[model samples]
Target: MNRAVHAVRRHAVMAVGVLVLLYLFLPVAVVVAFSFNDAAGRFNFSWQGFTLDAWRHPCRVPGMCESVSTSLQVGAIATVAATILGTLLAFALARHQFRGRASTSLLVFLPMATPEVVMGASLLTLFVNVGVATGFATIVIAHILFTVSFVVVTVKARLAGFDSRLEEAAMDLYADEWQTFRRITLPLAAPGILSGALLAFALSFDDFIITNFNSGTTITFPMFVWGAAQRGVPPEVNVVGAAMFILALGCVGGAEVWRRVRAARR
Candidate 1:
């Protein structure tokens, strides 16, 4: 009876997991299906018929490509800046015992815990008071600010499980500080760093609330999507969304395959 109960509980848990996944991905599946929609009206929500025109003319909508370009640039810059800063901060928090260490950690996580609207408003007010113009630079700054916390958290999780003995061994083998870090520490931390960077880029790329607050005249892809939604979303927007979903999936899949291959080789 106990074994049967245990088996039932396990099956129940698996069913719940599958249901949760379906709930999350159902919308994505709808979006992907609608990307090929040939709608007579501006709204692409209802599928009229399947056509390859949307994919062929992804930039058919005016300002669509431009917004995508702006988003890409901002995401790239913010990811690079946040990854570097967060990785260093994670290392410090993980390895060192300094004054106010607890306080510093709290501060690092505060941004992540803060509400997006509040953070956005605060940043907007600060920029206004500082006489800083709202544009691409402001958007990038805002993205970096929010994304840094995620990077720190992701990299810190990786660092938490890392073995410091490897670095110590490197040092014992006549490796200098820089050599030990470069050869031993960094290689182990590379997975975490890469994961953090990818996450930062995704956050920056998909962000709407913060970008809306900071971007005065600048339009990113999310902004463009919002504007289109107010009128009637273009099919091109769906195409872009579908393409982004596929690209992200491909990247994650490739990374998983690469990791398995490396493990097998080892």
Candidate 2:
């Protein structure tokens, strides 16, 4: 009787997991399916017919490509800046004790816990108070601010699990501080750093509410999609979404392959 109950529970758990995955990916599936849709009107929600025109002319809608370009640029810059700063901060928090350490840790969680609308509004007010114009720079700054917390948390988790004895062994083998870090520490931590940067880029790319609050004249891809939704979304928007999904998948796949290759070599 107990064996049968256990078997039933295992099946139930697997079913729940599958349902959760379907719920999460349903929207993404819809977007990818609509990318090839030929619409009778501006709205591409319903399938009229299948066509390759949307993929061929992804930038057919004016300003769509430009907005995508802006978003890419911002995401790239923000990821770089946030990764560098957050990695350093992670090292400090993980490896050393410092004054106000508790306070600093608490502050990091505040940004992550805060509502997006509140964060956006607060940033907008700060920029206004400082006479800073709301534009591309402001957007980048805002993204970096929020993204840094996530990076710090990720990198810190990696650091926490790292074996310090490896570094000590390197030192015993006549490796100096820089050599130990370069030859041993960094390679071990690279995965976490890479993950943090990818997370930051995705957050910056898909952000809508915060971007909307701070973007005075700048149009990001998300903002462009919002504007188009009022009139009618273009099929090109679906194409862009599909492209982003594919690009991210490719990157993740490439990373996994590289990791497997390195593991096999070792």
Candidate 3:
């Protein structure tokens, strides 16, 4: 009787895990499926039939391509700026000691800890007080502010496990500070930096609340999707969503393969 009960519990646990996974990924699956949907009107709620028109002419909807371009540009700028600044800050926090370090560390979490709506409103107010127009520049600044915190946290986690003795060994071999850092430090930190950059870009691209608050005339991809949703979302929107999902999946797969190959080599 105990053996039978244990078997039932194991099966029940497995069933629950499967159900939770399905619940999480069901929306993503639906989005990918509907990318091929041939909807006659603006609404893509039901599948009329399977077609590749959305894929072939993803830019059929006016202004979507432009919005996508804007989003990419903003994401790129924010990622670059945040990565550089955050990596430097991470190094400082991880490697050095200074007054106010504790306070700085806590302050770094301010962006992440604060609610998005509050941050957006604060940024808007700051821009207004500074007499800065809320447009592309403001949007980029706001993204950088929030994304830097995330990058700092990620790179710090990676650096925390790093071996400083490796740098000492390099120095013992007569390598200068710059050479040791370039060869030993930066290379080791590359994975974390790349991860942070990718994360920052994804956040900037998908962000709507902050962007909406800061972007006066600039329309990003998320904003465009929001506006379109009011008029019944277009099928092409699903196409973009599907493509981004595939790209992200590919990145993760490539990273895993690289990790395996490196482990084998080691």
lDDT of all predictions: 0.93, 0.94, 0.95
Q: What is the lDDT of candidate 1?
A: 0.93
Model 2 ranges with Cα > 4 A deviation: 1-9, 261-266
- Model 3: per-residue lDDT, tens digit, 142-250? 9999999999999999999988999999999999999998999999999999989988999999999999999999999999999998998888999999999999999
Q: What are the per-residue Cα lDDT tens digits for candidate 1 across 1-266? A: 99999998889988999999999999999888888888887877677998988899998889999999999999999999999999999999998999999999999999988999999999999999999999999999999999999999999999999899888899899999999988998889999999999999999999999999999999999999999889998778888999999998998899899999999999
Q: Please give the lDDT score at residue 144 for candidate 2.
A: 97
Against the true structure, what is each candidate's TM-score?
0.95, 0.94, 0.95
Q: Write the per-residue lDDT of candidate 2 for residues 174-252, one digit (tens) a residue.
A: 9999999999999999989988998999999999999999999999999999999999998889999999899889988
Order of models, best TM-score first: 3, 1, 2
Which stretches in model 3 have alpha-carbon errors above 4 Å?
none
Residue 99's C-alpha lDDT in candidate 2?
Answer: 100
